[model samples]
Target: MKKLPIILSLLFLTLCCVSCKVGRFVYYNLANITDYKIFPSRPLVNDSIVFHYYTTEQDKAKVPKKINYNGSEVAFDDFLADNKTVAFLIIKNDTIQYEKYFNGYEQESIIASFSMAKSVTSILIGCALDDGFIKSVDEPVVNYVPELKDNGLEKVTIKHLLQMSSGIKCEESYINPFGDAATYYYGTDLRKALSKMKPEREPGTEFSYSSCDTQLLGLVLERSLKGETITEYLDEKIWKPLGMEYDASWSLDREKNGLEKTFCCINARARDFSKIGRLYLNKGNWNGKQIVSENWVEESTKPDTGLGNVDYYKYQWWLSSGGSYMAKGLLGQFIYVYPSKDLIIVRLGKNYGEVAWPELLTSLAENY
Candidate 1:
């Protein structure tokens, strides 16, 4: 009966492995719900950065009770109640006009940015280009990431990646436990995970929103910076200089020198997030300091290429009608910038429902 022991051992090992895989899947899939409680994150420290407090003139404004959506009016309070909105803040003329928090979220509560980090990564690329670290956006990504050479990615340029036109064969299905998005999101070795990717079509020929495109861009930034972590680079280049109030955090694939998930997951206070919108609204200028080049800001937000209809996507930023642009996240997180009206609106929430964001923002801009 010695074989009984062997069979039991084998069964035990199989069960253990299955359990581990299932645990990982559950953990990563539920990150949206649980990460605000437990997740490894790297701090974007605000060292010696002066806090730019918003001028409190809260009462000089009125919150619209209802907004029109698809020819029908939706109650703003009903929208918030149904959508799990945690925080919403609006800044105009360099002052806080309206701010509200729900679901026990406070002014100090740090909310996850999700895919909004993609735009932040794009900004870092701009900073790298401005500093001459990257010679040009048209330069082949292989120039920075040599390992991608000889692969189908040989011809993919930085601009292609930024615009989500890389045509990489990375499926972005969040519901699939074994898909590319989950692998990149939960897997520890980013380079290993990326090595398996193959180009689906000619780069710069089409547009497809894939988080791996930003992850590759992050890799380019990491390679170009010569051993500097993106967290450090951002803190020194943008956060510190722009005077972000609270220290922010970026989630990593694993602990200690692990790659930051540049496609998503940056947790920061709502007020500080507004500063990002303000920076873009000021055309990359922060109180007269050119944090990102004005030309870069202009080019990044405009649809220069006619691919993917070019009406919405531009260098990781989502464009809208009325010359408005925004950095949007998967679950209703948004930093909407209205340059014409000099308005910055920040919304952090779990779901947006059927709320017409552009119409709502346009109405708010008109009223304010």
Candidate 2:
């Protein structure tokens, strides 16, 4: 009977993990492009309305299809396929100039764009501001999510979260199972998990790329929504208005009426994601119906370093010095827009795969 106690202890620990996110983390290994497949999600359903892009034979433009990578010349399509690219698209003048799918993916297949959801959340925030759900950017987050006041987040403004300058600290690593990333990504109760969060310093001093800042923005949005879920808000403001061709989903911290992870996890198909790039490319107007305010879109994609912020990141969108910007995510998901060329490029990959994607996109926008 000596081994009975030890066996029981091991059994207990195993059960505890099995009942929680740790078991999921162990099963999934590191976060992957497929993480959304295993998580409980909220549906963003579409109505009968749909918008089709303008296309023509002449709309498709030709460009350099061969490039030297790693000191060897390879076909650009082969290079993309070998480098884990699943879906790629180039849209110009509201038409799909080029579209390709590799690795057994199709236009109907779903891919999770982690952190690209941050830009979408910022869009919703802008919508809320326009709708009077949120007063202004300068308003403190505690005004919406009063629960955060206990963590000394009262000084943190909506702008701080949008700019990623909120000094509130959480471990940013995605590979660590016990870290905040895992806790927020896989935990069952985000409401409960949030109370454990504490600020590393006072608000809005230096730029820090923390997913926690984005989740806090999600929480603030949730509270201010007033009897509506975040998913519903997105559908009403974006999906329906943009006439997204396929239905998409947003990951939640739990299965039923749970808080959206909101820092990440907007599961969608590649073509549908292109519409986002298209939206910003036209400065947030979709077919003459303003989706988000033009002023908001300009503020989001513009490069600014003032107020302790980085020039490359503004309002949850990434900017380049030459007036290009993108919504980027882990595992190489991108919705790149170059307004100067009237081009929008979308790439969804399993991983970055030894390619500096931003530079490549810049080259394509400039030369193609």
Candidate 3:
């Protein structure tokens, strides 16, 4: 009888809170892999003309049977299994060398991209540039979003947001129920969350990784579009052109007429995710066609040590210490690319576990 009263109290409080972002966060608990089902999504329907890459399992490269990890040696297959990986793929020369799925996950199972969507957003930004929807990266963000002038964001640039040096004030903690990440993830109105944005310091002053930068970029992308949503733009430019094997969807802030959570939440299959790797591996050229400018692809992945920028990251893509880069996300999701060896590694997991994947991937690339 006492527990019933407590439960009813929580229910009443949840029903009464404005927006209910906090209540939704508590109700859903922490973010998980299958979030696609919990949230309504904008469909990313693939092209009718699909591109399929054949697999050559027998011609797979030799990987160490026993892998060394954080000073301890473990069986190579067991290592990925123990880390709760749902999908793992190693592609060489435009073919699948190794593919595995575990923990009730299959090849066709849909997996949420988490922050890997940031990299996809970066690609869309490049397309926006090519199509003349956006003039240049150096332009002040306020040119696209004048309403943010009073918020002290007039000095911020599109490049600044891409580089994560926008100096936007946001609490990035996923554990905090009141934090910006949780609110953005669970909130019904993304524009409402964006309207409350406040700057903490001068943009381009220091390197700071904030989801607010990416979310703001989404709004800019949204505003720049003529007669479409970001999801429609993605479908027309990337998904349909690239010929994705399956239909995917971008999760929205609401079930109907909502903006894409571009900072995260692109739900897709494993092989289809690898196609993104193949695109960049070919330097944004799919077959003989140029999907994005070659210069844009180079700038997006290459290290930049300029002021207020990081050599380890550029244009929402993470650069390795070596000649490799990745589209990384929360919970250890990765689209690691090693161009020197023509290798691409996709690892999607419940958590990253003990491995520092960037370093490990660098070492793994050396063998190829």
TM-score of each: 0.90, 0.94, 0.95
Give the top-scoring candidate (lDDT): 3
Clashing pairs in 3: none
For candidate 2, list the clashing residue pairs, or say none.
none
**Cα lDDT tens digits for candidate 3, 1-368:** 88999999988897676357888787777899899988888898987899977687544555557787778889888998898888988888877778889888998999999999999999999999999999999989888888899888889999999999998898999999889999889989999889888898888878888888999899999989966999999999889889999999999999777999999999999989988988999999999899999999999998877868878899999998568999999999999999988899999998888778777777888776
The models' CA-based lDDT, in order, is 0.80, 0.87, 0.89
Ranking by lDDT: 3, 2, 1
Give one digit per residue, the lDDT tens place, for model 2 in 107-148.
Answer: 898999899999999999999998999999999988987878
- Listed per candidate, the RMSD to the true structure in angstroms reads 4.1, 2.7, 1.8
Off by over 4 Å in 2: 1-16, 56-60
Best by TM-score: 3
Tens digits of per-residue lDDT, candidate 1, 1-368, equal 99999988876775565334334656445447235344567789875756564666545565566766567778866666566888888787887777888777888888888888999999999999999999999999889887777676898888889988888888898777678887776667777787777889987788889999999999899889998898889888888988887888888877767888899888888888888888889899988889999998998788665754366889999987678889998768889988888788888886676566666766677676
- Please give the RMSD of candidate 2 to the true structure: 2.7
Worst 10 residues of 2 by lDDT: 55-64
